[model samples]
Target: MTRALILFAHGARAATWAAPFERLRELTQARVPGVPVSLAFLELMEPRLPERVAELAAQGVTAVTVVPVFLGQGGHLLRDLPLIVEQLRLDHPGMAISVSGAVGEDPSVLAAMTDFCVAQL
Candidate 1:
């Protein structure tokens, strides 16, 4: 299957917040050479989830793994994401989609946050 990564970020009203996401996407794409990576916002931003998904489909992506770039399981992750996934599933029943857990829950991520916090203190 042609697999791709979809980084799901909670959108910010401040335009500057998007820079980090684009940077992260660039880094991730570099690390995973062949697979295409795209960013989708939950709110307050353009190219929302559906649009991003559509773009992926246009690229002939057979499977997409959605990684939520969140700190915790909050409303957007807990509730909204699933709804969007369901909508996509219905819209493209044949497409294979995998929803990965929040990246913040990863052990390495926690460790990195701790390291940053300690450095700040």
Candidate 2:
């Protein structure tokens, strides 16, 4: 059961915002240890979700899980992500794919974000 993890982020025009996501991918890899991980963007940034999915498929991954990095169940997650996932499903009919909830809406994540904001002021 080969599995791959795709970390999807809302793309940024500045490019610098992507650096943190790269760091995040590294951290996730370290934590998970065995699951193959990679980063993908919704827009602006390169290597869109479909492309990442293709890459994972090429690497012989039989299943892939997509993790959205957004803060809420916004239009991107509710509409765009499912569209992308459906497309990928068609494109990779042999591979099993699943999309997880947005990371930002997690309780621990919201608390951490609030802590960071409060500490700054």
Score residue 99 of candidate 2 by CA lDDT: 90
Residue pairs clashing, model 1: none
TM value for model 2: 0.94
Alpha-carbon shift of residue 4 in model 2 (angstroms): 0.6
lDDT by residue (tens digit), candidate 1, 1-121: 7889999999999999999889999999999999998899999998898898888888788899999989899999989999999999998776798999998999999999999999997
List candidate 2 segments past 4 Å from native.
none
The TM-score values for the models, in the order shown, are 0.96, 0.94
Candidate 2 lDDT, tens digit per residue, 1-121?
Answer: 7999999999999978999899999999999989988999999998999988888899899899999988899899999999989999999999999999999989999999999999999
Q: What do the candidate models score in CA lDDT, each in turn? A: 0.91, 0.92
Q: After superposition, how far is residue 90 of candidate 2 from its true place, in Å?
A: 1.1
Error of 1 at 49 (Å): 0.9
Q: lDDT at 89 for candidate 2?
A: 93
Q: How close is candidate 1 to the true structure, as a TM-score?
A: 0.96
